[model samples]
Target: MITSMREHKGHLYPGGISNKRIGVYELPDADISKYQRPWRAA
Candidate 1:
């Protein structure tokens, strides 16, 4: 997902499912464009 962040250039939200007995949690939205690293050679 990090690889796609550069192209998104917008807000990013987090979400995931938990086991039956567990509850879900909400995460703060991130403007991750500034945090994206430049593409590098492998």
Candidate 2:
């Protein structure tokens, strides 16, 4: 089984999962767009 994940717009979200055989099929790449959160000075 293959698990996928993606991060976009400052939040992380689950993309998808595949349970197919690895050798017979090509695996997809995970789409991810990570954002940096701003920190406030105390």
Candidate 2 stretches with Cα past 4 Å from truth are 18-42
Please tell me which predicted candidate would have the highest TM-score against the true structure.
2
TM per candidate: 0.20, 0.29
How far residue 21's Cα lies from its native spot in candidate 2, in Å, is 22
Candidate 2 local lDDT, 1-42, one digit each (tens): 436644444444444356433222223453333435544557
Per-residue lDDT of model 1, residues 1-42, tens digit only: 122212233434333343233222333464565766865658
Clash totals in order:
0, 0
lDDT of 1 at 2: 20
Per-model CA lDDT versus the true structure: 0.39, 0.42
Best by lDDT: 2
